[model samples]
Target: MQTFTLNDGNKIPAIGFGTFQIPSDGSTYKAVSAALKLGYRHIDTAVAYFNEGEVGQAVRDSGIPRDEIWVTSKLWLQDYGEEPAKKAIDLSLKKLGLDYVDLYLIHQPYGDVPGAWRAMEAAKQAGKIKSIGVSNMTPKIWQQFVPQFDTLPSVNQVEFNPYFQQTALRQILAKNDVKLEAWAPLGQGNQDLFKEPILNGLAEKYNKNVGQIILRFENQEGIIVFPKSVHEARIKSNLDIFDFELTADEVAQIRTLDTGKGMHDPDAPGVGDMLLSGVRFDNVAQKDSQKSNR
Candidate 1:
C-alpha cells in the first residue's frame, strides 16, 4: 500500500477501509477482518459509528503487527469539552481495545472544538494519539478554528469526490500543509457518477470499475481515500487500485465533472442542531433504554 506523509511527519496509507454507517452486529468485525486479510493495512472508524469495538477486535485478531496497520477513530461532537474530550478519547481507546490510535479526528465542527482540540493535543503529547485532525471542516471553519492552535492538523478528512471536489478548501488545507482525506470519495454511490461517460470510458480503458477509476484519480491527486464496503467481492476490488495509473489528461477529463456541490454542507442552517441531536454522553443511557423499550 502507498503511504502519504502527514504534516506531522507520520505516514498514513493512501487507501483505507471506511466503517461509517456499518452496524456493530458482527458485520463490522466480519468486514474489517476480511479487509485486513485482503491486505488492507489501514482501517478508519469512529465512535459515532458505534463499531469501534468490532473494528478493534478485527485488527487485534488479524495477526498483523499493530504498528504495521494504521487505525483511525474520531471524537464525537457530544464529547467536545476538554474534560469530556479526555474521557471520550479514553473511551474510544477502551472500545477499540488498543492503547493508541494512528489518527484521531474531531468528527464535526460544532461544539467546543477548541477545548476538544486541546484535549487531543494533550493526548498526543501523552502518546495516546499519534496524529490529530478534523473532519467536515469547511474553509470558513478551518480559517477560524485552526489558527488558535500551534500544532497544525496533520490531515482533514471531508467529503471529496468528482462532483463535489472541495477545490477552495483543498487549497487552504494545502497552504497549511494539511493532507486531504476523502470520506465519501465515491460520491456516496451516486448513480449519476457511475453513469458518467468519462468515468465509464476510463473504466473500460483501464479494465477497472468506475469505483477504481475514481479511487485512482484521488490517489494521484495526493489525497487519501476510504471506500467502504461489506460485500466480499467489493472489499477485495476496492483495494485493487494501486496497479493502474491515470494520465494527466485523463485526470483532467474527470476534473470537468466537478459540480461544486456536496451532499452535506456543514455551513447550512440548523446543521448544528441536527448534529447535536445525534448522540451524546449525557443521553446514551436514556437512548439505550428507549431502544430496549422498543
Candidate 2:
C-alpha cells in the first residue's frame, strides 16, 4: 500500500478501510475480519461508531501481527476534556484489546477541543498512540485551534471528493505540512459524483470504475482515503490504483470539478451546536461512561 508521511515522521497507508455505519451486530466483526484478510491493513473506527471492540476482535482473529494493522479510533465530543479524554484513550485501548493504536483523533471540533487535543498529544508522547490529529476541523476551525496547541496536528480529515473539493483548505494544510484524510472520497454514494463526465472519462481511460478513478485522484493528490464497503469485490477493487497514474492535465481537469464547498463546515454558524446536539452513542462506550461517573 502507498503511504503518506506524517509531520511526526510516521507513515500512514494512503488507503484504508473505513468502518463507519457498519452495523453493531456481529456483521462489524465479520466485515472487519474479511477486510483484514482481503489485504486492508488500516481500519478506521471510532468510539462514536460503537464498534471498536468488534474491530479489535477481527484484528485478533486475523492473526495479523498487531504492528501490521493500523487501528484508529476517535475522541467523541462528549469526551473532550483533558482528564476525561485521557480516560477515553485508556478506555478505547481496553476495548480494542491492544496496547496502542496507530492513530487517535479528536473526532469533531466542538466541546473542550484544546483539552481534548492536549490529551491526544500526551498520549502520543506516552506511546499509547503513534500519531494524533483532528477530523472535520475545517480551515476556519484550524485557524482557531492550531494557535492554541503546541503540537501541530499530524492530519486533518474532512469531506473530500470531486464534486466538493476543498481547494483553500488543501493549500492551508499543504503550507502547514499536515496530511489530509478524506472520509467520503467516493462522495458518500452521491450519484452525482459517479455521474460526472470528467470522472467517467477518466474511468474509461484507466479501464477502472468511477470509484477507482475518484480514489486514484486522492492518491495522486496525496490525500488519505478511507472508502467503506462490505462487498468483497469492492473491498479489493478499491485498493487497485497503484498500477495506473493520472496525468497532470487529467488531474487538473478533475480539480476544476471542485466547487469549493463540503458539508459540516466548522466555520459555518450553528454547525458546532448542531453537531454536538446530534452526537448519540448508547453502546459499550456509553455504558463505560456511566461506570466512570459512578
Candidate 3:
C-alpha cells in the first residue's frame, strides 16, 4: 500500500478500509478480517460507530501483529470537554483492545472542541495516542482551532470525493501540513459513480473497475481514502488500485464531476441538532437486529 507522511512524521497507508456503516451485527468482524486478509493495513472506526469491539476482535483473530495494523477511532460530540475527552480516549482504547491507537480524531467540531483538542494534545504527551486529528471540521473551524494549539492536527478527515472536491479546504490543510483523509471517497455510490462515462472508459482502458479508477484518481490527488466494502470481491478490487496510475488528462476529465456539495453538512443550521435528535443506542441495537434477521 502507498503511504503518506503525517505532520508528526508518522506514515499512514494511503488507502484504508472504513467501517462507517458496518452493521453492528458481527458483520464488522467479518468485514474487517476480510479487509486485513486482502492486504488492508489501515482500519478506520469510531466510538460512535458502536463496532469498535468487533473491529478489535477481528484484528486479534486475524493473527496480524498489533503494530502492523493501523487503527483509528474518534471522540464523539458528547465527549467534548477536557475530562470527558480524556475518558473517551480510555474507553475507546478499551473497546478497541489496543494499548494505543495509531490515529485518534475528534469526531465532529461541535461541543467543546477546543477543550477536546487540549485533551488530545495531553493524550499525545501521555503516549495514549500516536497522533491526533479532527473529522468533519471546515476551514473556519481549523482557522480558529489551529492558531490556538501548540500542536497542529496530523490529519483532517472529511466527506471528500470527486463530487465534493474540497479545493479550498485542501489548501488550508496543505498550508498547515495536515494530511487530508476522505471518509466517503466514492461519494457513497451516489448518482451512478461506477457508471460514469469517463470513469467507465478509464476502467475499460486500465482493465479495472470504475470504483478503482475513481480511487486511483483520488490517490494521485494526494488525498488519503478509506473506501468500505463488505463484499469480498469488491474489497479485493479496491486494494488493487496500487498497480496503476491515472494520466493527467484522465485526472482533468474526472475533475469536471465535482459538485461542491456534501451529503451531510455540519455547518448547516440545526445540522448538529438533527444528528443528535433521533440518535439512540436502542435505535442502533434495533437496526443491528434487523440486519441480522435479514
Candidate 4:
C-alpha cells in the first residue's frame, strides 16, 4: 500500500476511504465494511459527519487489527475552545470506539483556532492523536495558523482536483513539509469535469475511467486522497490506481483544467461568517435516531 510519510514520521495511506455525508443508518456501515474488505487501510470521518459511530463499528467488526487501519476524524467549529476541543477529541475517540486516531483535523478555519491547536498539540503529546492537521485552509489561512503551533500541520486537507488544483497552496505545503490530502478529489463526480477532453483522453490512453485518471494524477503529484463512494465497485476501483503512472505531458494537460473553482472561497470577504455556520449534524443525528426508534 502506498503511503505518505507525515512530518511527524507517521505514515498515512496514499488513498483513504472518505466517509463524508455517509448516513449512519447502515449505509456508512456497509460502505465502510466494503472498503475494509477491499483493502482500504485508511478511514476518514468527522464529528460534522455524524457517522463516526457507523464507521468505527465497521472497522471493529471487520476483524482487522486496530494497528492496521489509519483512522482520521475532525473537530467541529462548535468544539473550538480549548476545553471544548479537548473534550471533543475524547468524545470522537469514544464515538469511533478507538483509543487513538491516526490523524485529527480541525474541520474549518473559523472559531477559537489557537485554543483548539493548543488542545490538539496536548493530545499529540499525550498520544491520543498520532498526528494533527487543518482542513479547508487557504494559503493565507494556513500561514496564519502555522505560527501558532510549535510544529507545522502534518496534513492540510483541501478540495483539490483538476478543477481547483490550489497550486499556490500546494507550494506552501511543500515548503513546510506538510502532506496535502485532497478532499472531493474527483470533483464530486461532476460529469462536465469527467467529460473534459484532457481527462477523457487520458482515460482512453490509460484504459481507466476518468475518476481513475484524476486519482492517478493526484498520486503522481504526491497528494493524498480520500475519495468518497457508497458503491462497493467504485470504492474498489478508486483504490486501483497504484499500478500506473501518468506521463509529464498528461499531468500538464490535466493541470490546464484548473479553473480555481472550489467548494468555498477562503479569501472571500467575511468568509468566516459563513464557515462558522458550518454543517449542522445534530439535526441529521436526531432524524436518524427517530428512524431507528421506529
The lDDT values for all models are: 0.90, 0.87, 0.85, 0.87
Query: Who wins the TM-score comparison?
Result: 1
Query: What tens digits encode model 3's per-residue C-alpha lDDT throughout 1-294?
Result: 789999899999999999998876688999999999989999999878888878888888889998889999988877788997898787777776678899999887876788999999999888899999999988877776678777889999999888889988999988878999998898898867767899899999999888898899999999999899899999998889988889899899999988888888777898767655535443453343344333
Q: How displaced is residue 51 in candidate 4, in Å?
A: 0.4
* Clashes per candidate, residues 3 or more apart or on different chains: 0, 0, 0, 0
lDDT of 2 by residue, 199-279 (tens): 999999889999999999988999899899988889889988889999999999999988877754667888789877874
What TM-scores do the predictions have?
0.95, 0.94, 0.92, 0.94
Candidate 3 TM-score over all chains jointly: 0.92
Model 3 lDDT, full chain set: 0.85
Residues 1-294, candidate 4: write the lDDT tens digits: 888899999999999999998878799999999999999999999888888878778888999999999999999887798998998888787777778999999888887998998999999999999999999899898878778877689999988988999989988889879999999998887888988998888889889998999999989999999899998999999999977899898888888889977876877888788767766555564554344334
Model 4 stretches with alpha carbons more than 4 Å out: 277-294
Deviation of model 1 at 237, angstroms:
0.7
- On lDDT, the leading prediction is 1
State in Å the error of residue 290, model 3: 22
- Residue-level lDDT of model 1, residues 14-107, one tens digit each, is 9999999988778999999999999999999987787887888889989999999999999989889899999889878877878999999999
- Please give the lDDT score for candidate 2: 0.87
